[model samples]
Target chain A: MLEVRDIHTYYGDSYILQGVSLRVEAGQVVALLGRNGAGKTTTINSIVGLVPPRRGEIVFKGETITRAPPHHIARLGMGLVPQGRRLFPNLTVEENITLAARTGNGSARWTLDAVYALFPRLKERAHNRASQLSGGEQQMVAIARALMTNPDLLLLDEPSEGLAPLLVREIGRVLADLKAQGLSFLLVEQNLHMATAVADWVYVMNKGQIVFEGTPQELLGNEEIKHRYLGV
Target chain B: METLIIQLLNGLVFSMLLFTMAAGLSLIFGQMDVINLAHGSFYLLGGYIGLTMVRRLGSFWLALVVAPLVVGALGLALEYFFLRRLYGRHRHLDQVLFTFGLALIAADLIRWNWGAYVESVPPPELLSGQIPVFTVQFPVYRLSLIAVGVTLALGLGLLLERTRIGAIIRAGVADAEMVSALGIDIHKVFAGVFALGVALAALAGVLGAPVLNLYPGLDFEILILTLVVVVVGGLGTLRGAFFGSLLIGMADTFGKAFLPEFALFLIFAVMAVVLLLRPSGLFGLEGT
Candidate 1:
């Protein structure tokens, strides 16, 4: 449901993403796997117009949205659980979620009640400021905040980056549940196990370019590809 | 005993006025990280505009309402045309330089129009006399100013604490990028906030003009006081501004009243103590 084609992004004068391209179909979890400095986050940011691509196009549900502002892109049913879970440190858990609430596509599936049901710990700590929460709890709040937008395409950048194993597993379960609900996702992950477990398709990126694309089973079976590119 | 009581009332009145001017300055700095050297220009603009309105209509209340709107529009224009382009550039010095230039320009404009002479506005009829309290008589207008300042403070506190827009503003202050990503048009938010802050300063100026007097150089005087307030209150805390104003206000008032020769030293002395103790102001958050 989302297409990013030959996008170039820059941070100051340094070109971070060099003609990177990817696609995610409806009701699919597509993994963009890469090592450090692979431009995965840059690709995601370019799509959301956080770091607008200087070249190429981004299309979402048949509309070219390359030049749209970040808020406008967000309003167009794309949610980003940004790396580091950049929650408002002073806002309460509930405020963080409700602040992003929008009926972008007239879908009410991801309301406050729905989010609370997904993370009951958030409901219990709804009144506590985001900084008061543990890292895992903060991640949950960040996810729930993005979900409140009821986005058509959710971009998750390193959701499991700093979480414990148990929290990572819980995050995996949440992604599985979200996949069952027919939400498309472009997940940028460093954890191969979690990516393989949740993602239907995989694209390995190296040196600002996508080098491999296949079904998760195909990539798992290709030992040479994993050893050379992913070191797994 | 009468002199002490009169000085006590004077301290309260001055503290309240300081609160009015400092609160908006604190919010703008805290939320946008904009130093806004032009803030005092808005205050000066308010007094000049209010002077004109009061002269034409002979009504303090009318000037109070009209002056802020004019100064606020000016602030909105400044944000849209100038300050919006400087975001996230570590352009703090550039912002200071630009706004300091703007302050100088504003002062020049006021001078060109009103000249350098100090002009005074008399209190309205109801507030023209003094009210006796215990053996001291206080100017009814000063007491009225204290009442208005307190009311505005409470109203602002409620607006920040209880309203959804206030919640968004507070959130924006903490992480503006996150707020923008959450479907908020931060450009619009920033403009509106800057305008609101300017309007508050204007309102304080109009309310205070009768006491402080109107002159072109008034901007520099109030600007220094505002810097002191912001520094002592920490950068972004509203509560800090309030308490800091009170501390400075009381110090300035009682020091001048009791020890006229050392009153200026008292203001700096209080700031020194605060710096030695907290370094971030009395209520400001550290590393903000």
Candidate 2:
């Protein structure tokens, strides 16, 4: 479980996440929905300590990782599939995954074989350079790269941003399967359908604040909140 | 015809020497985005230290082993104390200016301690003689440099491409923040790379001493030559550095041998042509 309390983040003088807060229970798929420039990615960056929040605290499982460095935060059992997939273009698919592989807390549940089984397409192109992969394949590589760390929680930032509809559904199915395997994750998304489909609970963000928080059914029924905040 | 062959071999020797120096510059530039003008200072410092070791200990081999280690420790200290303060994409100009200042200081220190006299190390006794090649006698040491350069290129290439550390370094070069978020301490990687880059330069210094010699402004000369190689090869890739060094080294050697008056312009001419054809250098990626 993770708890973010009144976190304020900034990029120089321009305030990004203005006292935003959210949470994810263990083994739950929590979706944070927001429109363009709604501080979704900034929130993720804050939690990962890439841009540490200037205010408030982030409690991951039990440790306070508010001002820790990015790598230290990661070692404290967090994995990030950063926005844009950020794969080392020159590295092979296998190298990209294996580079991030760490044996943390002695729970090596996610190995190369396990992730390959989850996304068999990656195995077929294991030795190919990451730059040569398709968008969907790159996304899979990114996800696989995160899983290789065997972290307690995964933070996914806009995993379906540029994928085709069919591939988006495939990602949704993968998320569902990951959730079934008891993987806790906080997914940032603009895709309402995919978020609502896999997420156990949902938080809608707008202008750097959490504007709505409720069950998926509660969110689906609220047309005004959906239309105004998410622009759906 | 024999003169041409000798000059060609001479070009090969200089190319290998340039590769040894440029590879470090390229790695530092590629991995940390730090344009360390002090790189040349490290080379000069290494050479001066090697000169002292060879004079006092009477062993070129001992100096070869010690100079790099000493310079590498200095590099580690430089990264920790000074260079660490000037990191980030926007602070590149600051890093460059800071390193230039460091180079000036290093040059002065070397002058004060070692004096301004030109000094050269003798080749090891085993490699002291000459071998006949195509009716021309070549220094065995010079010929051995070609072997040394090739071995270093292969060793460095293997260490970077085949090992996990190499994969991490390549990843860091591509996207350091993403690498850290994956549980890697990128700062440690940065420090290690900075040390390694300068150490390689020091190794080149010791290796190149017998031929190039040590003097007051050789640091700047070596620095300029290295910058040309990195620019010609492209930044961030070892292959680029290797090929670029060869191109620039051969051009410089042949130019000096054939058209001595235009020797300085020839290397630049090669660089200009390469840039016109591929703006990113021979092995550099686009937008690097």
Candidate 3:
């Protein structure tokens, strides 16, 4: 479980997250929906310690992790699939996945075999350079790289960005399967349909603040909230 | 043919020495993006340390081991105290200025301790004789230098390209933030690699002491040579450093043998042309 409490984050004097709060229980898939500049990435970044919150506390599995360094937080069982799929372009696919491979978190760990099983295409291109892979394949490698860490909680920032609609559906299905297997995710997305399809609880963010929190059906049913906040 | 062979051997000997120094400088440059102007100072300091150890212990082997370790410890302290603070906060000319200051101080310290007079260490008795090579004879120590340099090149190449830690370092070289996000303590890697880089430079300094003699201005002399080698090789990888050292070494050697007057100018001209053609240098990756 992860708890981010009223965290105000800033990039220099420009305030990004003005008192944002959220929570994800174990095994829950929480989606944050907003248009551009909604501070979704900043929230995930704050939690990951890349951009530490200017003022707030983040607790991961009952421990305060707001001020921990990014690497330390990652070592504490929190994984981040960062935006832009920052893969080592020159490293082979196998090297990319295994370079960050930590010992698994729980009893049933995610191994290279498990990740390969999830994305068979990755196994086929094991020796190819990461830059040679297609966007969808690169996205899969990103997810697999995170899973290699065996994180108790995974934060995905725009996993479906720049993907085809079919690829987006495939990503959603991959998340659905992972959710069934009891992986907690804090997903930041612009796609409402995909967000709703996979997320258990949805939070609508606007202007660096969380404005609405409800179930998937509740979020879809409320057109006023959707139109006003998420710009749907 | 005999004259050509002699010049080529001379070039190879000098190339090995330059490679030993440039390999470390290139790796440190790639990893930290810090132009450690003080790097050659490590060589000067290590030569003095080796001189002292060789005299007191009466063993070239012991001096060889001890001098680099002493210089490496000093380098580690320098990183922890001074250079460590500069990371992220200081990127450009400030780092150069700081390391440049260190180089100055190191030169002064060497002068103060060892005096301004040039000093030299004799090659070990076992390697003091000459060995026949084709038509001419070569000093056993010079051949030893070639052997040492070749072994180091292979060993370092394997360690960087084959191991998991090497994979992490190579990846970090490509993208640092992602490596950190993967739970790698990148700062530690920087420190470790920096230390190794300095240690190797010091080791080369100790090894080359007999070949080039020990002097206060030696730091500045080799610093220029190392910088030229790193630039000509490329910027990021060990392979680049090795090739760069060879190219520059051969150019300098043959240039000197045939055209002693214009050798330096010609070498610079060749280097400028190489950069103009391939800005990344031979075997170097882009973006430093």
| Worst window of 10 by summed lDDT in candidate 2 chain B | B199-208
CA lDDT of A116 in candidate 3? 98
TM-score for each predicted model, relative to the true structure = 0.96, 0.99, 0.95
Best lDDT among the predictions, by candidate number: 2
Question: DockQ score for model 2, please?
Answer: 0.93
Runs with alpha carbons beyond 4 Å of true place in candidate 3? A104-108, A228-231
Interface RMSD for each of the candidates: 1.0, 0.5, 0.7
Summarize candidate 2's per-residue lDDT along B1-288 as a digit string, tens digits: 998999999999999989988999999998999998998999989888989999999999999889999999989998999888888989988998999999999999999999999887898898999999878999999999999999999999999999999999999989998999999999899999999999988988888899999997999999999999999999989999999999999999999999999999999999999999999999998777
lDDT for position A140 in model 2: 97
> Tens digit of lDDT per residue, candidate 2, span A15-87?
9998988889999989999899999999999999999999999998799999999999898889999899999
Model 2 segments more than 4 A misplaced: none
If you assessed candidate 2 against the hidden native complex, which CAPRI class would it receive? Answer: high
Question: What would the per-residue lDDT of candidate 1 be over residues A1-232, giving only the tens digit for each residue?
Answer: 8988998889989988888888999999999998888899888888888889899999999889998988888888889999999988877888888887887666578888899999999999999999899999999998999999889889999999989999999999999999998999999999999999989899999888898999999989999888877888
Pick by DockQ: 1 or 2, better one? 2
Report the TM-score of chain B alone for all candidates: 0.97, 0.98, 0.97
Ordering by lDDT: 2, 3, 1
